[model samples]
Each structure stands twice: as C-alpha cells, then as structure tokens.
Target chain A: MIFDTTAIAAMDKLQRVQFATTLPGPKPLCLVGTRSLAGRSNLAPFSSVTHLGSNPILIGMVTRPDTVERHTLRNILETQSWTLNHVTEEFVAQAHQCSARYPEETSEFEATGLTEHHHPSITAPFVLESPIRFALKLEEIIDITSNNTKLVVGRVCFVEIPDESYSPDGTVDISRSLASTALDTYFSIQEVSRLPYAKPAPPTP
Target chain B: MIFDTTAIAAMDKLQRVQFATTLPGPKPLCLVGTRSLAGRSNLAPFSSVTHLGSNPILIGMVTRPDTVERHTLRNILETQSWTLNHVTEEFVAQAHQCSARYPEETSEFEATGLTEHHHPSITAPFVLESPIRFALKLEEIIDITSNNTKLVVGRVCFVEIPDESYSPDGTVDISRSLASTALDTYFSIQEVSRLPYAKPAPPTP
Candidate 1:
C-alpha cells in the first residue's frame, strides 16, 4: 500500500515512530558501554550504529534528544571513549534489559548480570560475554539541528573478534553472532551467495 | 583476536576498507533511485542507508567524495528528491550491477533491465519490481571533513509497501522481501523470536 506524507502525518506518534524505525529493516544491534567520570559504567542497547568511513575507520550512532539525562551520551562526552559489544542470542534477554531506565548510579552490567571486561588500551569497558566488540574514541559529535538528535562519530581504536569469524576478504561472518532486529525480534541470517564485483555485461556479438 | 589501531593502520588500504566495512556486520541494502534534471533515471546500490530520526522520518546515507561525477548525489542535490528501493533476492544481481560506472546521461533502469515507476507526488522514480520503496526529500547535507564523505539526510515524504508486508504495530516483515546484505553477499533472515519490552525482573520474594 502507498503511504504519502499526509497519511504518515495522520499516524499517531507511537505508530509513526514504530513505522519509521522498523521500515528501515533489521539493523546491527550492539550494547554501547561507557563510563562516567566517577567511574560508573553505563550500558544501553542501540541499533543505529553504521559505518561512516573506512580509511579512518569511523562508525556513527544517533542518540535521541537529551530532554532527559542521557547517560550514554553524557558518559561518552565526559570520557571521550566507548565500546560497542555485538548482541548475540546467548545474552539477548540481558542485552534487551539494558534499555530499561535506571538511576544514574545503577550500572546495567550489575543489573543485567553481564560481566564487564576492561581493555588496557581504552578507558571504557566492554561486555565480556560478547564475542565481537570494538573500543572507540570519540571523534565528533554532530548536533543534527533538524531534530534534537546527536550523531556521535567514533574512531575504532581497538577490535576484538574470534579469529574464525574473520573472512579472508575482510568480511566478518556475523551469521554466528545471532544479530537481532527491530524492537524485540531476534534473527539468524543465512548467507545466500556472494557474487563477484558487479560489472556491465560484455556486449553481445 | 584483538586488533589495535596501530595494527589496523599497518594494514594496506584495501584490507582496511574491507575490514572496516564488513566488521559492522550486514547492512540494509537498497537501490537508491533518482532522476536527473534532464529526466534520466539513475539507480545505485547502497548499504549505508541508516535511520537517523523518527519524528520527521529522517534517513541518512553516506556518499563517497564527489571527486568524480556522482550521478545519484548530483540528481538528489538538483531535484532535492530521491527514492530508496529495498533490494530483494530476485533482483540482487541487477541491483548490484547498478554500481557499475554509468555516464551521467545513461539510466541504470534501462541498462540493468529494471523497470522504473513514477509517483505523482515525487519527482524521482521508484523501482517497479521493489515491494518496498520510499520517496524522500533532501533535508540536510553533512560534510565529513575527516574523510571527504557526505551524509545526505532525507525526510521520508512518501512510502510504498505491499499491504501484507506491514505489521499492525509498524514492523515491516522483510523476511518475505528477501533483503540481502554485506558487500556482495545476500541473506534470507529467519525470525527467531520476538520478546516483550524489557523491564527489571520482579524482586525475589
């Protein structure tokens, strides 16, 4: 069915948000880990992460308006460092719980019973159970004036993944990572095929 | 295995790009459609399309430096409109072929044998074969000075989807759509389960 802006505008706020978020299809899910100046750790689930560039190895994630105290945003800004831990089926429930609102002092790791693993090179801690994780240093914080959202760009300073998951061509086989999608749906993607770099068909004789 | 920034820097440029792009896991693949001022249609495959905000229904895609003539970016900037058609398994090969270098006057739809459908409200054309598509108006163009990339933010003004594919709560069932992922790889995702909103477990009695 076709939905024009008028039809979309007619939708209630919740419906609009749900439609907009889910229509983008499945996104890469991760647990963003950060630490406050006082050493308090914060963990939150985000699906907005996307590759911004490769040369400098940058990744960007959008954070909603800071109408309320946003612990993740605040921590990242204060510490200038954060970690992204890929969510897998083994701890999907625990990862989901990270979204729940908690007091500023309450750490999701403690609340969700997830272990925190500290890397020597970065100040932020990562989820020990997560098979794939990356430590990033804050590069830029773009205030998307269009809405109050903030686009946080981070430089990947460190990465940890199982050796077997890394393909020779540099593609990480996340099929075993058990990536989830949407608000509550979990999925296991099956590889169809990887074709060679596309080229125009040779002219017919 | 763990890889530090120094290690990443040591790798060749090609390996770095491949590792950085794939390490983020699968992305939402789409054939971005646009029309030049002269009315020539252009289609290009992009996996960087990401959800930025829901209020204005904004989506962002990264465009490599316009050092060379980028038809899709040029068209969108000139007309201030574009369409994003989700790439499905059936047309994966054709969609990939759109990435081939085509002159500014050439239409990928004609060259790749894909049909273009025009909508009355939008200047750009949508893929006739795509079950899911979106018409967007240019909202903002963010320049990433760190690496000459452009993040084009578009406000979703119109959307078209098969009636059956949309769920009541706003989730679009992409499984049936056969959405593919990675650089050249395709995948059919299987929904494992949908859990309820996460809340702290009730305190033990």
Candidate 2:
C-alpha cells in the first residue's frame, strides 16, 4: 500500500503513534529506572532508547510533551542519574505494566513485584531480574522544537551483564541476554548470523 | 562482567565503536537512499535510524562528523529528501556491501546490484526489492556540540509497503516483511506475541 503524509496525517492520534512506532521495526525495549529527590523510585518502559554515539558513549530516549506529569523524566532531572534494564520475555508483563500511570509516590518496581537493585555509585535503582543493565549519568537534554518532545541523552557510567553474554570482540550477544522489542506488541528476537565487516568485493576480472 | 566509562574509554577506536553499536541490541537496519543535485544516487546501510515522534511523523538518524565526505548525508542535504529501505535476509549481503566506502561519483545501487524505484512525488529513489520503504523530507539538523555528530531529523512524506504486511490498526507485521537487524551482523527476527495494552491490575475485592 502507498501512503502520503496527508493520508497518514488523517489517522487518529493513537493510530498514528502505533504506526510510527512500529515503522522503525523491532526496537530494543528497556525499563528506565530513576529516583526522585525525595528518594522515590520510578520505572517506565521505553522503546525509543537509541545509541547516539560511541566516543562519549551516549544513549538517548524520547519523552512526550509534559502535558501531564512524567514521573520518569522528573526523577531523572532530580537525580541526574538513571538505569536502563533490558526487558526480556520472562518479565515483559511486569515491564509493560510500568507504563501504567501510577501516582508519583507509587514505585512501579514495588507495584509490579520487580526487584530493585541498587549500585553504590549511582542513586537510581536497576531491575534485579534484568540480565543486562546500564548505570548512566545525565549528559544533555535536547528539546526537539518541531514537536514538544524531549530527547534525553545519558553517558554510560557503568554496565553489568552476565559474562557469557559478552562476546570476545567487545560486542554483547543480546540474544543470550533475552532482550525483547516493543510497539503495541512484543516480539522475541532470534540471532540469525553474525557476518564479518562489509568490504568491497574482490576486483572482478 | 562489569565495565565503567573509564574502562570503555581505554579500548581502541574500532573496539569502542563495535561495542557501543551492539550495546543497543539488534538495530533496525536499512539502506538509506538519496540523490544529489546532479541526480546521482547513493545507498548506505545505517543502523542509527530511529523514530523520533509521531505527531509530526519525525525520524532521526545520526551521521558521524563529516571529517571525511559522507555521501549519504551529502546527498540528503543536497536534495532535501531521502528514502529508508529496510534490509532483509534475502538481500543482506548486497545491503551490507552498500557500507563500503565507495567514491562520491559511484552509485551504490549499481555497485551493489540493488534496483532503485522512484515514486512520482519524491525525487529520492527507494530500493525496489525492499518490502518496506519510507520517503522523507529533511526537517531539521541538530549538531551534537560535544562530539560534532549531526542528528538529522526528517518528516515522513510518503511510504510504500507490501499490502499484506500492514495490519488493520496501523501496525506493520515486519516478520512478514523480512526486516533484519544490523551491528556487524544480520539477524532474522521472530515475532513472539503481541500483547494487549498494559493497564493497572485490578485491586483485590
């Protein structure tokens, strides 16, 4: 099917969001953990998290406009730190529930029964059940002026993962980490093959 | 295993790039197509493309500093439009080869044997073999001052996809489209299940 912007714009808000989110294909789902100034914890599921660069080791995620209070964004701004826990099949239901609009005082970890693990160096808590997690310090917040959305960039301060999941060459075998994707739906990823770097084909005779 | 930013920084450039790219999990790989003012076509595989918002239908992709000529970025800037064609298992080899540093004068479509399909309204050409494709017009370019990387945001102007791949409620069944992931490797995705929207659990009676 062919769709122009006019046709796409005709879609209702929910439909437009659903379509746009899935268009980018399976996204890596993560539960962002943050803590408020008063020491309250928050957890929220985000599929928008993306790698921005490597040298500074920056990662970014988008948050909708602050029409309503955003607990996760509030906590991040208060603490200047956050944790990202990769969502897996085993606890996806719990992770998804984090999206529920819980009261600011309520902790998703406690409400959903997911264990909160804290690192001494960072104020935010990590999901104890998560196989792979990152402790990140706030780097920069970019305001995407076109839309009211905000892009939060964080620098990796520390990372924790099972030794087996770490490939010898520095890449993490995420399939072993059991990372999943999110849209309006959830999907389990299967690693097909790890091909060598792409190089120009040998000169043809 | 545990890694801190200090440890991550100690790794050489190639190792850091490889590690950082894969840390975000299997990324939605695409062959970005663009055209220069002279009508020259270019295709390059990018894993950095990400959905930025839905209201305005925005998408963003990161481009490394133009220390060296970046053909894809150059073409998009010249023409103000580009196409993102999802890479699939069948043509991954050809898609990967697009990453080769071909000269500015070279056409990756011809070099890699991928066919270019043009829509009536968009000047940039899409890959004919790609089951899912998007035509986007440049919206904004934001510079990440810290690293000098460019984050190019584009608004969706047109989209073409196999009719069967689109679901009734605006979601695309990418498994049917054969979209693959990239990070020094290609992976075939398996759709596990699509769960309903998460709502707060009912309280005890």
Candidate 3:
C-alpha cells in the first residue's frame, strides 16, 4: 500500500513509529558501552551505528531525545570514550535487555549477566561475548535541525575481530552477526554471493 | 587480534578501508534514485540509509567526497526530492551495477536495465522491482567537520510496502530483503524472532 505524508501523519503514534522505523530495512545491531566520569559503566543497544569514514576510521550513531539512551549519551559526552560490540545471535537477548530503563547506578552488563571486559588503554568497557569490538573516542556531536536528535561521531582507537571472520583481503564477514529491524524484530543473515567490483557494461552490439 | 590506532594507521589504504568498513557489520542496502532538474535520472546503491527520526519520518545517508555518489547528492540538492528502494536479492546485481560511474547524460535505470516507475505526485522515479520504496524530500544537510563527508537528511514523503511483508503492528518484515556489507558482500536475511518491549527486571524475591 502507498502511504503519503497525510496518510502517515494519520497513523497512531505506535504505528507511525513502527512504519517509519521499519522502512529503512535491516540495520547493524551493536551494544554501545560507555563510562561516566564518576566511574559508572553504561550499556545500551543501538542499531544506528554507521560507518562514516575510513582514513581515520570514523563511526556515527543517532541518539533520540529520549531518556533510555540518555545515560549512554551523557557518559560518552563526559568521558569522551565508548565501545561498540556487535550483537551475535547467542547473546542478542541479553543485548536487547540492555535497552531497559535501568537506574544510573545499574550496569546493563551486570543486570543482563553479560561479562564486561576492559582494555588497559581504553576507559570504556566492552562486551566479552561480542565477536567484534571497537574502542572509540568521541570526535563530534552534530545536531539534526529538522529533528531534536543528535548524531554522535566517534574516532576508532582500537579494533578486535574474530580471527575466523577476518578475511585475507582485510574484509570481515559478518553474516553470522544478528541484524535487527524497526524496534523489535531480529534477523540472521546468510552470505549470498560476493561480486567483483562493478564496471560500466561493455558497449552493446 | 587487537589493532590499536597506530597499527590501524600503518595498514595500507585498501586494507584500512576494507577493515574499517566491514567492522560495522551488515547494513541495509538501497538503490537511491533522484532526478536532476535538467531531467536526467540517476540511481546508485548505498548502504548508509539510516532512520533518523519518526515524528516527521526523516532518513539520513552519508555521501562520500568521491564522484560516484555525487550525481545522486547533487540531484537531491537541486530538486529537493529522491526515492529509496530496498535492494532485493533478485535485482541486487542490477542495483549494484548502478554504482558504476555513468556519465551525467546516462540514467543508471536504462544502463542497468531496471524498470523505473513514477508516481503522479512525486517526480522521482521508483524501482519497479523493489518491494519497498520511499519517496523523500530533502530536509537538511549536516557536514562532518572531522571529515569532509556530507550527511544528506530527507523527510519521508510517501512509502510503498508489500502487503504480504507488512504486519498488523505496523512493522514490516524485511527478512526477505537482501542486505549488503562492506562494498561487495550481499546476504539474505531470515527472521529469527520478534522481541517484546524491554522492561526493567523486577526486584529479586
């Protein structure tokens, strides 16, 4: 069915949100880890993690004006450090549980029974169960004038990848990673085929 | 293995790009279609399509400083309208071929042999083979100061979703959609589960 602006605006709040969110298709699910300046560790699930650049290895994620993700936003702003851990099927339930509105003192790691590991060099904690992890430092937060949301940009400081998934050509195969859509649906992906780089089709006879 | 920033910086350019890009895991693949004011149509494959907000239903995509995506970006800026079509496995080959650097006068639609259909209310053409398509209008552009890349934000003007894939709860099942990772890898996703809203755990007995 076709839904125009007027039709979308008429949808109930929940329906509108689901429709809008699901329209983007599947997104990479990651558990964002951060620490408050006062020494509190925070964890939350986010599918907004996106690749921004490669030269300096920049990543960007959007944060809404809601309270659920506020702790993560605050901690990243205060400490200027965070970690991104890919959510695999094995631990996706625990990762999803991190979205609960727990108190500031409550660490989702402890609440969900997920192990928290730390590197000596980075202040942020990483999920021990995650197969892929990245230590990042906050680089900038750009505001979306159209909406009140904020885009948090980070610079990758370190990376840990599963040796099994790493390719000789440097690409990491993440078909084993669980992807999420909209607000609640989870999916497991299987690699179909990797094609060669595209070039314009040869001139037709 | 863990690679610190220094180690990442020391890697060759292709290696660094592949490693950094693949680390984010699988991303939603879409064929972005736009029509320049001069009446030339353009389509290109992008995995950066992200849900920015729902109230106004905004979508954001990162455009690199390279020339490949410039045509789509310029058309969106000039015409203030565009279309996003989810790339399905059946036509992903043609969609990926849209990434080929075609001349300004050539429409990726005709070059790739993908049928383009248009709506009476919207000027941008939609991919006839795509199951989910969105008509969007330019909302805002946020620049990443750390890098020279641009974030093009668009407001959803209309959406067309397959009846079979949409659910009563307003979410659309996109497991049938093909997702892409890094630059060349594609995957078919399956719906594993749909989780309920997360709530804080109750006090222990």
Candidate 4:
C-alpha cells in the first residue's frame, strides 16, 4: 500500500510510529552511555547513530523530544562526554532493557545489570559486554525544527574493538552485531559478500 | 585494541576511512534518487539514512564533502525533492554499482539497468526494483562544520511498501533488506525475535 502525507497523518498514533521508524530500514544499534552532573551514569539504546565523517571521526545520533532518551541528550550537552557501545547478540536483551523509563536517579547500568567500564580520562561509562566501543566528546546539537528532535554530533576521542574483529585494513568485522528493524524487532547480521570499490563501466550503448 | 585521537590521526588515510566509517556498526542501505532542475536524474547508494522523527516523518542522511554524492546533495538543494529506495539482496549489485562516479548526465537507472518509476506530481524517480521506498521533500540542511559535511533532513511525503512485508502493527519486516558495514561489506538481516514495549520494573527493594 502507498501512504501520502495526508494518509500518514491519518494513521493511528502507534501505527504511524512503527511505520515511519522502520521506513529507513535497519539502523545501527548502539548503547549510548552518558553521565549526569550529579555523577549518575545513563545507558540508552539508540539506532540513529550515523557516521558523519572519518577524518575527525564524527558520529551523529537523533533523540526524541519527549522520551527518556532526552536524559542522554541533556547529559551529553552538559558533560560533553559520552560513549557508544555496539550491541551484540549476547547482551542485546540487557541493552534493550535500558530503554525502560527509569527515574533520573537510576543508572541503567545498575538497573539492567550490565557492567559499566570506564576509560582512563573519560567520565562516561562503557558497556563491558559490548565488543566495539568509542569514547566521544560532544561537538554540536542540530535541532530538527519540524519535529522537536535533536541530532547530537560527537567527535571520537577514543576507540576500542576486539582484536579479532579489528582488521589489518582497519575494517571492523562486526558481522556479530545485532540490529533492530523496528522498535521491538531485533535481527543478527551475516556478511554475505564484500565487493570491490566500484569504477564506472564504459558508457553503455 | 584501543586508539586515542592522536593515534587515530596518525593512521593511514584509507585505513582511517574504514575504521571510522564502520565504528558505528551496520547502516541501513538505500538508493537515493533525485532530479536536477536541468532534467537530469541521479541515483546513488547511501548508508547514512536514519530516522529522525515519526509524527512529521523526518529522515536524516549525511553526505561527504568530496564525492559523486554531492550530485544528490545539489539536486535536493535545487529541486527540494528526492526519493529513498531501500536496497534488497536481489538488486544490491546494481545498487552498489550506483556508487560509481557516473557523469551528471548519466542516470544510474540506465547505467545500472535498474527500472525507475515515478509517482504523479513528484519528479523524483523511485527504484521499481525496491520493495520499500519513500518520496521525500527536503526539509533542512545542517552543516557539520567540524568536517565540512552536511546533514540532509527530509520529510516523508509518501511511502510504499510490499504488502507481505508490512505488518498490521505498521512494522515493515525488511528482514530481506541489505545492510552495509564500512564501505564494501554487505549483510542480510534475519528477524530473531520481537520484544514487547519495555517498562521499568518495580523499584528493587
């Protein structure tokens, strides 16, 4: 079926959400770790993470205006420090539990029983169960005026990956990474093939 | 292994690209279609598409400073309209071929042999081979000053999905949708399980 703007607006609230969120297809699932000024740590699952650049190693993620995820946005804006831990099948359930609307005083690390680890100087926590992770410092927050959502941009200050996953060419083989299609549906990725960089073929007749 | 910012900066250029791009994990794959005001059409593969909101149905994508993708950015800027077509395993080879630096006058549709279909009143072309697609209108472009990239945001004006893949709850079971890690690696997703809406458990005693 096809849905135009008017038809989409007429969709049931929850239905529109499921449809719109998954329309972009599977997203990169990561557990964002942040710390409040009071020293309380926060962990939230986000699938909006996108690679913004490589030279400065920038990443961007979106946060809804009216969700507990705002806590993460607020913490990042205030502390300017956070961590992105890639969720794998082994701990996806625990990572998904971090989405629960726990009170501000609650640390998802404790609430969800996931071990929180810390790098040398960064204050934000990292998931011990996550095989690939990054320590990041906030750079900018772009507001999506149409919807009150914000795109949080960060510069990678530190990086971590398992030796096995890290390749000599610098590609991290995260085939074991778990992905989400919608809010509730989860999937595991299997690398089918890796193609060479494309070079345009001679003009077709 | 771990690398600090300084260490990351010292790495080889191509290695850095692979490392930083895949740092966020697998990304949603889509063929972004746009039409220049001059009447030339363009198609390019993008892995940056991310859901920014649902109510107004916003999606965000990132574009590098120097690449053929700039054609996509320029067309959207000039025409204010575009289409995002999800890539599936069947046509991934053709979709990946879109990344080839075809001349602005060449439509990837013809070069790659993928059929392009248009919706009435919308000039942007949609991939007829794609199972899920969206007609989008340019909303805003936020410049990533840190690295000179731009975050292109668009509002969904229309949506089309396969009847069999779309569920009653509005979820699109794009388990067949292809995902990419780094630059060349592609993966297929398998829906493992769908969890219920998470709610915070009663405060532990």
Candidate 5:
C-alpha cells in the first residue's frame, strides 16, 4: 500500500519532536558515557543518539534547539566533536539518570558516578563505565523548522565495542546489552521477527 | 552523562556503530506512500523518513545518496511536492520489496504492484494503499556529508491519519506502524515500552 507524502504527511505530528521522548525504555546496561569541554570529563547518558548513515559512519541526535546560546548544540558547535557509548541493560538506569540536564558549566563526569576514559585517536573522553563508545566529529547542525527542533548530524570518527558483541563479519549480537526503542506513548522493544540477509541471492544462479 | 565534543570525538567506530544501531532486528514495515508525476504513479520505501521538526511541521528523510539520480529526490525536486504514508506490519514485506533499485525511468508502482493517487495541492503522486498519508513541499535539503547521504527536509503541507492512531492531546500514536533497525546485519523492531509524557510537577500542598 504505497502512501504519498501528503497522506504520509497527514499521519499526525509524529516527527518534529525535541529530544525524542521515551518511557521506561530498555536502556543499555551501565549507561557509561562522559561529557566535557576543552579537555575536561563530563560523563553522561545519550539516549537520544541515533544513526543516520553507514558508509562514512554518521550518527545524529535531535538537540534542544537553542534560541539562547549555551547548550549541547553550542558545545558541539564550539568544540566540533562528541562521543557516544553503548550501555548494556547492565546500566540503563544509570544512563537514564544521565539525563540530568546539568548546568552548562558543570562536567557530567564529576557529576555522575560513571567513570571516564580518553580516546586514543581523538581528543574526546568516553564513558569508561560503558564497554563500548565512539568519538564523532560534528558534521552539521540542521536548523530544523517543525516545532523547535534541531537535527544534529555527526561523523563517527572512532568506535569501541566489547570483543564479544560483533563477529568477524560484523555480526553484532545485542543480547548481551539491554537495548531500547521509542514508541508513540512508550519506550519498549518487543521482538517481532528475525530476518537474515536475503540469503545471498541463492548462490547467484 | 555529559559527553563533550573532544571526549565524544575519540570513541571507536565499532563501539559507535553498535550504539547508533538502535533496533536490534527486523521491523519489516515500510509506510507505503505514493506521488503522482505528470499523471503517473510513484511508490517508494523510506526507513530514513523521520520527522525533523513539528511547529510549522517539517518532515525529513536521510536518503541513500543516489544511484542513477535519486528517483524520489528528483520527483520531489521537480514537483516540489511529495507524500508520506503509514505502512503497517501487514504490508512491510511489500514495502521492503519496493526498495528494489529501478532505473530513473521506471515507476515502482508497476514493479511492486501498488496503486497511485494525486492530490490537488501538489503535483506529485501519492499511495492510495495507505490508510493515511500527507502531502509536503520541499523546505530544504542539507548534505550531511560527502560520503553518500542527504537529508531531505520538507514542510508538511497536509496530513492524514486513521482515527485510532491519534491521542486526544494532539499527538500521533505512530506505534502501530512497523519499524526497522540495522543490527549486525538484520532489521528488527520490538514493542519496548510505553511513551511517558512527563506528568505535571507535584504541587506543594
């Protein structure tokens, strides 16, 4: 059933959301992440993080569009960098608490109980608590027009995952970490199906 | 945790990829939508379609760069109009199949056996199969990067949803539609948790 952009458009206000709100969702365990400016540590949970591309490795987040000058957007703009850590169900609660919207001047690292680590290649800090994390360079801050939303795109520069998560061929098994999702009125993840890669075209003949 | 630009910038790619790949497995659903071009029908699937804003109502999609000149992108560019339709779990199979790369001259409506409709407000065709859809006008297109991705942003000119999908408080209950996430290699969506709109602050009786 093909839907047109208009009919698709008519589907209610599902998109233009600020900081995509989720419920008691499935959070990664040990939501270990860090935040900072210049070179300080500010550990935090980034539940709003999302993926935008795979080729060059891009990630995104809908930030609090600042009519004012100070915020995550400003920090990204000023520093031109950021990082995301994958927390397993082991620490999602801690990750949620990371949503503490700390004052701009404070560091989440000192604020949250999570530990911090430094990336070897990039200057960013990462959540030592998180088994996995990645550094990213701010690519753009799209001034989204809907309600007051800003789409922030980042280029993933580095990544860190526990050795067990991905197989040699890049097959990731998230069963180890408690992951999550965003629904209209809730945040949950219920298994629907398991589809393998379209069976490799049945041996091509 | 407040992760900083420098701190966030140093994490690794594998770590970052796992964090950004939100849904663990197969959410075999695509909102089938249509658009009419020069009185013809066009059908396409966009897992990348996520609302970027909501005030004036903006919709955006992170399209796969383009092979042979981006059909939907070109259509929207030419007509300055397009639509979005909600695809349910029922039609996800057909929706995923529509993503087959057809040449610029090919119409997906024919390849995937979809119906098409046109709106009076915009010249682009839309999917008649969709129970709900919306027409839109292009607002902006930002190049997220040089690799192979483009964010197509548009203004919601019109919208349509089933009566059941909407809540009383001006929100769209879009959970009924299927979702897809890039796992190590598959796509899946689960019913994670209910959305939790924050309740009012407690009164200081």
Candidate 6:
C-alpha cells in the first residue's frame, strides 16, 4: 500500500506535544553570578538541559520565551556564561530548597542551607554538593516557531565528574547519580541497562 | 553560575548513554526512485520534522550525515515523493522487523507483517498501522556541510491524524503515540504537560 499527503498530514499533527519540567533534583544548584543587574546570587532548578550538537559541543535548554522575572535568563544574557550542576539523590531536599522565590541578594544556598563551590577555570559558582557539574558559555539562542520557548544553545567549557560515575568512553553511568525527572511527576533514574547498538543503516542489500 | 565550554563538554561525554529501542516509532527515511534501483524503497528516519510554513502546509526534516545503504534516501531521490510513517507501539514491532537485512526486492512491509496504505496524492506507501503518517514532495535537500548527511526538506503533500488523538488546536496528543530518542538510545515518552510558550530572538542580539 502506498501513502499520500492525506495520511502523512494526519500523523504529523498527532506527534506534536508540549514539555514542562519543573521538578527539583536531589542536589541544588547555586547559580553563582559575578555580575547581574540585580546583583548578588540566585539558584534555580531547570530540567530542560539537552545536547544539540557534538562538533561544537552544543548544549541547550528551554527558557521562558517572554520571562519578565527570569533572573537566570538575565544572568545568562548578561555574563553570557552559566554552570549546570546535577542534583544527586542525597541533595534532593536541598535542591528543592534552592528553588524558593527569594530576593536577589538572599543567597539560595544560604537560604536553602546548601554550600557553594567556585569553578576552577570559570568565574561562575557551583554547588559543591552536586556530584556532577559543568560550566558553559552561551553560543546561540534559537526561538522555535512552534513553541513559546527559547532554545538556549551553549558551548561546554569545563567539567567535574565524580570518580565513581566515570566510564572509559567518558559516558556517565546514571545508576548512581541519583537523577530525577519532572515529567508532570517526579521520578528517579536507578537501574540503567545498555543494549546492542543498531548502528544507523539498513541490512546490506 | 556561568558555564564554559570545557565543563559542558565533559558532562555530555560523561553522561552519554546507549538507548534500547526497536519499537515502532520514527525511524530513518528518505526518497529514492524506482528507476534503475532494484528495490522500490528507501530507509532512514527524519529527526528534523518541523513546520516550514503553515499556510502552504510545508513540512521539513533534516537527514543528517549518513554513510550506508539507506532505502529512504534512494527512494526519495528517485521519486519526488516519500511517505513518512510514525513508529507506534503497536507497529514498531513489525517496523523493526522491516529494518532487518532483506533482499532489495524484499518488500519490508510484506516481510515485517505490516500494512502499507497507498497515498493517492503521491505514489508513496505509508504504514497504515502507524498512529501517524505523511506523504510529501521533495522541496529541497541541503547538506549542512560538505561531505555531511543531507538535510531532506519536504513540502508536506498531505497528512493523517488518528481521530481519537486529534486535539483542539488541530494538533494531536503524542503521549498516546509515544516518542522515541534518535540518539543511540530510544526512550518512550514517559509523560506530557502543557506550557503557554516562550518568545524568540535570532542568533544575533
């Protein structure tokens, strides 16, 4: 049977979906800022982080398209750099505390009772409590026409990975990281398995 | 905290994971011709499915760099139109079966025990069992870089959305259809939520 435009259009519409991840992780991120219009510090939990490309090592996350009060967005736009810290299973409670809406001067780390660590190469501050952390610089920002979000693409600059979580190929095993998801609900990544890699190709003709 | 490239790169390499998906969902696709080609099909998946312009109902997908025997590539190239099928939970079984190494003359649809619905608008065959499908014409094919996989942009000739899956905005809810990752791993969409939308800005300030 052959398919025409009619059938093609039908399925395309059905595949559209919306994504909103607001859940906090186990560890809180102390988004340390050296320069901000409002000054001092801010901490927030974001789960939209994703890698877009490898050649340039591009990482992206969706942010408020028209955020009137996105201090993080202001910081990224101002300093053009931001550090991403993963909240492990142990820091879930502390990570949640940093998410509180607070005055710019009120340090979320102090307010949430979490400690902060300075990145060795970059000027941004990181959460010493986070088992995994990475620093990045803003590369490009693409506003998708289909969604009300800004796809913030950045370049990775520096990183700190717990020794226990490291692999030979440089992949992080998620089993022990204590990662969580904000899929309209909270979930943890406990047991992960690797399967045969069906390398991209059709069976030889 | 601000992120630099080094740190960001480290995290991606560290967290790199392998996916296990043989389910019926999006796979590699392309447009090949029946001219001198021994088979009447192409193989590959479209990762860049997007609305080029709603007025004309143009849809596009990027067929990044490939170096293999892909039926989707030749079929679209030989013929102007190709059928885009959505890999569904039900049909992914047969779809994956179609991906097996078979003779060029071997009709994947027939071997996999799946039904292909013919499209009248074009001469392509769509997967009837798929929750979503589309028939499109080759509007353009651009290689992002020399010697890289080409980005096959198609002008949606037609579409099909399941009756129960259609939403109020003419979009269908995909959670019912299930989403898969194209990376080495394929993850079933675990959840879905709503967000108003984000505003946009270009690459340049």
Clashing pairs in 1: none
Q: A20-132, model 5: which lDDT tens digit per residue? A: 22111122222323334665544544334555755456766655554221355556766777666665444545555455655556565655566667756565677776655
Q: For model 2, state the Cα shift of residue B178 in Å.
A: 6.0
Best candidate, DockQ? 3
Clashing pairs in 2: none
Q: Model 6: per-residue lDDT, tens digit, B48-113?
A: 343334333544454433322355666667776776665545544444444344556666655565
lDDT of 1 at A88: 80
Which candidate do you rate higher for DockQ, 1 or 4? 4
lDDT of each: 0.81, 0.79, 0.89, 0.89, 0.52, 0.47
Candidate 4: segments with Cα more than 4 A from true spot: A203-205
Q: Which candidate, 4 or 6, would have the higher DockQ against the true structure?
A: 4
Candidate 2 chain A weakest lDDT stretch, 10 residues? A176-185
DockQ of each: 0.69, 0.67, 0.84, 0.82, 0.20, 0.12
lDDT tens readout by residue for model 2, B1-205: 9998788999888777777777766567778899999999999877767788887789988887552228878888888999988877788888877877777788889989899898889999999999889989999888766566777899998988889887767877677333233356777777656677766667779
Could you give candidate 1's per-residue lDDT for residues A1-205 as a string of tens digits? 8888888888888778778877676677789999999999989988778888887899988898652228999999899999988888788889888887777878999999999999877899899998889999999988776777877899999999999987666677677554455667777777877888776667679
Give the Å shift of residue B23 in candidate 5.
10
Q: Answer with 3 or 4, whichever has the higher DockQ.
A: 3
TM-score of 1: 0.95
Q: lDDT by residue for model 4 over B1-205, one digit each (tens)?
A: 9899898999899999999988988889999999999988899999999988888888889998699898999899899999999898899889989999998888999999999899897879999999998889989988777788888989999888877877787887787788898879899998777788888988569
Against the true structure, candidate 4 reaches a TM-score of 0.97
Looking at model 4, give its docking quality level.
high
Winning candidate number (TM-score): 3
Q: Write the per-residue lDDT of candidate 3 for residues B19-99, one digit (tens) a residue.
A: 988888889999998999998999999898899888889999999868689999889889999999998889888988998
In terms of lDDT, model 6 sits at 0.47
lDDT of 5: 0.52
Listed per prediction, chain B TM-scores read 0.92, 0.93, 0.97, 0.96, 0.71, 0.68
lDDT of 4 at B150: 86
Model 3 CA lDDT for position B112: 90
